[model samples]
Target chain A: MRRIFTVWTLLSVLVCASQAQSTGSSDSETIKELMQEIKELKTRVAVLEARQGQPAPEQAAAKPAEPVQETPSAEGQTLSPERISGIFPGIRMAGFGALSYKANDARPPEAGLLGFRSGNNDFAIGDVDLFLTSHLTSKASVLSEVVFSENSEKEFELDVERLLLKYDFNDYLKLSFGRYHTATSYYNSVFHHGQWLQTAADRPLVVEFSDHGGLLPSQGVGVSITGKIPSGSLGLNYIFEYGSSDIHRPNILDPNADEIVENNGHATTIGLFARPDWLQGLEVGGSFYHDRINPDGGPFHLGQSIGSAHVVYLTPRFEFLNEGFIIQHIIEETGQKLNTPAFYSLISEKLGAKWRPYFRYQYVNAPLQSPVFSDVQLRHGPSIGVRYDYNDYIAFKTQYDRTFRRQLPDINNLLLQLAFRF
Target chain B: MRRNWKSIIVFVALLSLGAGCVISAQSKEEDVAVIVNPQNSLESISSAELRKIFAGEKLSWNSNTPIFMVVRAPQAHERDILLSRVLKMTESEYKQYWVKKVYSGDVPREPLALLSNGMQLEAVRAEKGGIALISLADVRQGVKVLKVDGKQPGTAGYPLK
Candidate 1:
C-alpha cells in the first residue's frame, strides 16, 4: 500500500505540472489578445481625443482610405468603400461627376430671357451628384441627393434632386416622405442622377432630367408607399405617390422648353413593376400621372394627365430599355385640349468587361397647340454612343446625335464625356 | 559589457522563437468556434443554418425574437473563414451584395460589425439573441460555442477546417 501511494503521488505531480503549464499558456494567450485589443482601443481613443484638439490631424488619419486610389485593375472597386460596412448610425456619402465637350450643328439655342448665357461649343462641368444615405434605426432611414450643374450664367448651380425619409413596416410595406423622383418610369426614378449607374453618358431625350426638359414631372414633394406583391414567383412590386410641385409651362415661340402647361400643381402617380422569375434581368412597368397646374401669378390653370409604360432588360452582357408616354393637357378657362406622344428606346451590348456600344432612338410628336412643340416642333432623333469603362470608377463616352429639328436641316452634334464615381 | 548584452539578446531571440512555435501548434485552424448567447437553446446547427443566420435570411430564433447578429470586421481571420467555408463570398463581394440589398430596401438592416472579439462577446452578452464566432480557446461563461454540422469544433469532419 505504501508503494502504491508513492506511485500515485508521482503520477499526480506530473499531471498537475502539465495542467498548470497548459493553464498558464492559455492565460498568456488571453493576455496577449487583451493587450492587442487595448492597443487598438487606445488608438481609437487617441483619435477621438486628438479630434478635440486638432481637426485636421484627425481627418488626415481617418481619411487615409483615399477615394481616388489606383483601382485601375481591381473589380473590388465596383462598390464604393462607403457602401461597404455601411451600417446604421453612420453617414455614408458618395458622388459622381462628369466633364464634357459638346459641339452643336447650329448656333446653340439662346439662354434664358434673364440674359443667362451658355456657350454651344466648350468644355463644361457636366454635372455633379452628392448622394447621402443614413440609416437612423433598424427600420428608418434617409436618402438625399443634390446635384450641381452649370447655370445659364456660366456658373455652377445647385439643385435639390431628391430627399426622402423612409420607414419600413415590414417586408411588404414601406412609407416614404419628402421630395422624391416621381415614379414615372424606372429609368427616371431608378437611374436618375448617377451617371455611372446608367449605360449612357446622357439620359434619353424622352426621359431627360426635369431641368433638361424631360417630358415627365421629375421632382415632387410627396408621400410614397412601395412594397413587394409577394406573388411567390412573379416578383411583382408596386409604388404609389401623391405629390405637389411648381410647374414650368412650355410655350411655342417661347424659349422655355419642357416647361409644364401651368405652374405649381398637385400631382398623383401610381406605378407597378414586375420581374418574371424565369427571366433574370427583365422588368416591365407602367404608370399613370395626373396634375392640376395654375400658371405662375396668372389665371390660367392646365389640367394634365399622362400615361406611361416601360420595359427593361439588364445584364452584365447586354441592356435594353424602352419607354413611352402619352401626355394630355386641357385649358381650365379656354376649354382647349392637346395631346403629346413621346417614346425612346436604348439598346447596348457589352463587347467585354470594359467596352460597351449602344444605339438609342427617341421621338416626340407634340401638336402645334401644345406649348412644348410650339417652339421645339415635332422632335425626332437617333443617338449612337460607345462607352468604355476604364475602371469601375471612371468611364469615357463619345456620342454622336443626328436629330431633325423643325424647319431646319438634320442637326448633327458630338459629345465627349468623362464620368467618374467616388 | 557590450559583448555580454549581445549574448543575452541572441539567447532571448532564440527563446521567443521556441515559444512562438509551441503557441502556434496549440492554436490550429479548426479551433474557431461559432458562439452564441447562453440564452439560446441551439446546441447545434447545420452549416446551412449558420450561413443563413449570417446572411440575414434567418432573422428570428424559435422564440420569435429578432436575431441580432454580430460579425467580425471584414479583415478578421474568423470572418474570412466563415465567408469561405459557409458564405462562399469574397469580402468585397459580400459588402457589395449587402450594399445592394440595403439600398434597394430588400432587408431592413445589416448585421452590426464589431472591431474585436471582446466587443463581440460583450455585444452578444448584452443581447440574448446575438450570435458571433470566436476562437474555441476563448470560450467562457455567459456564451455557448455551438456544435456546427453535428461536429464540435476541433473534432474530425468539422466543416470549418
Candidate 2:
C-alpha cells in the first residue's frame, strides 16, 4: 500500500510537470506568432510609407512647395470619401447650399424686404456657395468664394463674393489683399454666407448686405491687416482695413466692364476685440468705420461713420450673441447729421447632440428722410427657430418671424430650410 | 480515492495557469506617446501648446516648418484620449470644429487621418514636419517622442495615459 501510494504521487508529479511544459511551449509559440506578425506589419508599413512619400503624378508636376494633401489607406481597395482628397492635392474645397420653403401673410410692395418675397408662399432656392482655398507656399495662400442664386426673374446669377490673397508673417500680423467682407461687424466677419454655420435661418435685418437693399457696405476692395496684440491672457486682437467702400456703387464692381471704374472714395475701419483665456468662448469687441458716400443724382457727398459693438459667448452647447450699431450720416454741405441705431440679441441652447432651439430679437430704426436707407423704416421683430442636425454635415431648420413696421401692418412669416455643407 | 486526489491536483494546476494567462491578457490603461519627426528640435510641449497644435490654431513650428499633423481616424482609442484630454471636445464637436475652421479659411487643410499605429509611425518617419500620437508599445526608431508637461510616458504622474 505504501508503494502504491508512492507510485500515485510520482504519477501525479509527472502529470503536473508535463502540463507545465506544454503550457510554456504554447505561450512561446504565441509569442513567436506575435513577433512574426509584428515583423510583417513593419514591412508592410515601410512599403506603404514609401508609397505615400512619393507624390502623385499630377502633384509632381505641380509646385514643389505644396505639401501632400492626404494618402489613402493601403487596405482600402476602393476610393472612399476620405480618399477623394488625394485628387485635389493641396487645394481644399468646401461648400454650403440651402433650400427653403416660405409662407408669409399679405404685405404691400413698398413694405417688402429685398431678399424676402411679400404676400406669396413659394419654394425658393437659396445661395449655392462654393469656397475654395489653396496654399501657394508655407506663408502665402489664396481663397475664393463664388455664390449662385436665383433672381426675381428666376434666372441664375453668378457672383464672386470674395477673392483674397493672404500672407502671414507671424501670429501677430497677417496681410490680405483683394475683395473681402468688410470687418465692420462681427456677423459679417464670422458668419459670412454660410447659412448652415449660423444658428438663425437668415441674417438680421440690421446687418444685411448693401446689395440686398440693406444699409451697410458689406463688401470692400483693398488691403486688410489683422493680428494678435500679445496681451498675456486677455487675448486681444485687431483688424485694420483700408478699402474701396461699396456704399454707393453696386457690390459687384462689373468684372466684365469695358473700363475699370475706380471707387469714388476710400473706407477705413479699425476694430479691436478680446477673447480672454480665463473665460473660454467669451468675445467682446468694438469697431468703427469711416467712409464718404456720394449718392447718385445728389450734388453733395455724405460723411458716414459706423460705430459697432458686440459681446458674444459661444460653446458647443450654448451661444449668446449681442451686437449694436449706430450709423451716422452727415450732409457735408449743411453739416446736418442723422443717427440710426440698430441692435440684435440672439441666444440658443442645444438640447442634445442633434437639436438646438434659438431666439433672436432685432431692432432697426432709420428716419424716413434718411438719405442712405430711405426705404428702411422702423423695423423691430423677434425670430424663434429650432435647428435639427441630421448629421454633422446637414441641418434642418424651422423658423418663425414676426416683423412690425412703422406705418405698415405687422407680418408673420414661417420658413422651413434644409442647409448642408460638403 | 487516490485517483480522485491526483485528478484534483492536476486540474488545480491547470486552472491556476489559465487564470494567470487571462489576467495577463486583460486590457489596461496604457500610456500614449506624442511622436514627431526625428529632425524636429522640440523636446517638450505644454498642455496649452498641445491643445493649440492639435486644434489647428498653430500652423508652423518654431523652425518655420509648416506643421503636418496626423491623427488616428474616428472610433480609435488614441483619438478618444486626444479628444477628451487635449481638445476637451467630443468626437462630433471636433469634426464640426475642423469643418468650420477649414471652411472659414483659418487653416489651409485639416490634419491627415490615418488607420493604424504602424501607419502613423511610418508617416511621421516620412515627413519632416509630421507629428502624431501612438501607444508606447508601438513606438519604434526613427521617430522622436515628445514629453508632455515635462514628463515622459510610463513615469509616475504622467499626464497622458
Candidate 3:
C-alpha cells in the first residue's frame, strides 16, 4: 500500500509541476501553499501519535498498513486521501459475459439449438465495455467507452459511445456537445455493460432493444443541456441530434454474408430525461425517437417512430423496474401499421451482500399483420435468475427463462453470465 | 425435557439482552480516523488541509504522490462524522461530490468499509496512507494515529474530546 501511495504521490507532483509550468502564475502559488500545508499537517500528526505511545513517524512509516487520517478541516470535515489521489486524470475498463440454454416441449422450425436441450445450447458474450475518461480542465472533461461482443473476435467494433465534452457551467447547469449516447429510455442511458452493480442479470425485454436492432436512436452526433430544477434537485437532461441512424444489418440473413446491404438512413432524435431525488435512488423517465430510412431501392424501405416510458427504483437490497414501448411504421410507402406494444417488469432482491435473485416478465405483440398472415402473434415469458457481485470489478450471473408463444409449446432456456469493469 | 427447554430459552434471552446493551452503547460513539501514507514526512495536518484533500481541492502531498481519498459508505456513522468534521458538509454534499466527480471522470476509488474492528485493522494495514476511525481501544500496531489541529489523540488538542 505504501508503494501504491508513493506512486500516486509522484504522479500528483508531476501533474502539479506541469500545471505550474503551463499556467506560470496563480496556480504555482496554490501548489506551494498546498505542499506547505501538507508538510505541517504530517508533522503535527506524528507528534500526536508519539504522545499517545503509538509508533513514532519513522517506525510507523516503515509499516505499509499504518492508517493515517489527516486532521479535520477548518470546518471540521475529514478529508479522504483516496479522493486527493484521484484528482489526476485516469482510465477505467469494465465488461460482462453471458451463457444461456433453452428447452422446448416440441420442435419449432425457427429454433436452433447450440446450448439448448431440444433446442439450441448457446454460449454468448453479453457485453464487454472499456471506459476512458480524461480531464482537460477543472470544469471540463471527456468520456469514451467501447463495447465488444462474441468473444471480442469477429463481431467486435467501436461504438463512438460517449465522445462528449462536458462543461460544468455551474452547480446546477451543464452543457455538452459531440456524439453521445442519447438519454432515451431510462435503461438506454444506464449502460447495461456496466450492469454489475444492478440487482438483476438481464434488463427488462422491453428496454433490451439492442439485440433486435435499436428501434430507438442509441447514439447520435448531437448537443445537450442539463440542469437542476429550481428549488429542487430534479435533474433534467435534454438532447437533440441531427445525424444518421446507427448502422445495422437485418437479422434475417447470415451476419457473415458480404452482400448484406447496410441501412444508411438519415435520422434525428430528441430525448428528455429527468430524475428527482424525492424518492432517493429511484429514477423515472421517458423518450421519443423517430427514424426515416430511404433504403437502397429494395422493398425494405424504413420509416418508423418509437417512444417509451420507464421507471426504475434501485436500492442496496432491492430493485423494481418497468417500461413500455410503442412503435409506428409505414411500409412500402402505402401500407401503414402500428407495431405491437411491448411491456416488461422486474423485481429483484439481494439474497446476501453479494448475491441478488430476481424475476422478470415481458410481452410484445407482433405488428398488425396483413390479412394473409392469418393470425397476429405475441411473445411473453417469465424468467428467474441470480447475480453475484464477485467484487466491485466483477460479477457472475445465471438465469432460467420459460417463454410462452401464442401458438406453440413453452420454450424454456437458461443463461450464465460474467461481467467485469476496471 | 420440557423444563430443560424452557430454562435454555430463558438463558438465551438473557444473554441476547446483555449483548444488545453492549452493542447499543458501542454504536453511540462514532469511531473514525484520518489516514495518510506512512511514507509521508509531514507530522500534523490541520482541519482545513484535510478538508481540501477530501474535497478534491488539494491535489498532492508536498508535491508528491497524487492524494487518493477513500471514503466510507455514505450511510456509515464514521462517514457522517468525517463529513461533518472534514468537509463541513452534510451527507447530501458528499453525494454531490461523487456524482460530479464521476461525471467528470475524476471519481476517487470507491470507499472501502470494514464492519468489524478486525476488518478495519486489516484494511489500514493493507493499504498505505489508508486512514479511518474506530474505537480508540481498537487502535492496533499497524496504523499511526495523527493529531488534529496540533492535538494528539489523548492530548487536550484531540478533536473528539
Two-chain DockQ for each candidate model: 0.07, 0.27, 0.08
Interface RMSD of each: 13.6, 9.4, 12.6
lDDT of 1 by residue, B22-50 (tens): 87666546467888766678899988678
Chain B TM-score, one value per candidate, order as shown: 0.80, 0.84, 0.66
Per-residue CA lDDT of model 3 for A149-189, tens digit only, reads 43213254445556767765543445677766655566666
DockQ (model 2, Cα): 0.27
Q: Each model's number of backbone clashes?
A: 4, 0, 73
True contacts kept of each: 0.00, 0.17, 0.11
- Candidate whose lDDT is highest: 2
Query: TM-score, each model?
Result: 0.65, 0.79, 0.57
Interface RMSD measured for model 1: 13.6
Error of model 3, residue A106, in angstroms: 8.5
Q: What is the C-alpha lDDT of each candidate?
A: 0.69, 0.75, 0.54
Cand. 3 TM to true fold: 0.57
lDDT of 2: 0.75
Clashing pairs in 1: A247-A264, A248-A259, A248-A260, A249-A260
Q: Write the per-residue lDDT of candidate 2 for residues A182-236, one digit (tens) a residue.
A: 8879888877777888888888977876654456778899998987787877889
Give lDDT tens digits, candidate 1, residues A1-422.
88678767766976798799899989999998778668456434433443444345343343232121112121111111122223233677778778777776554453331112344466766568887788665457788878887754557778888888988665457789998888877777767676666677678765776565566777889898987686765778889999897645333223544344446567899888887756756889899999876644456667888899989997556789998888888888899988888888999997856789999988987776664435545778999999998876788999998887677567676888888878
- Highest TM-score scorer: 2
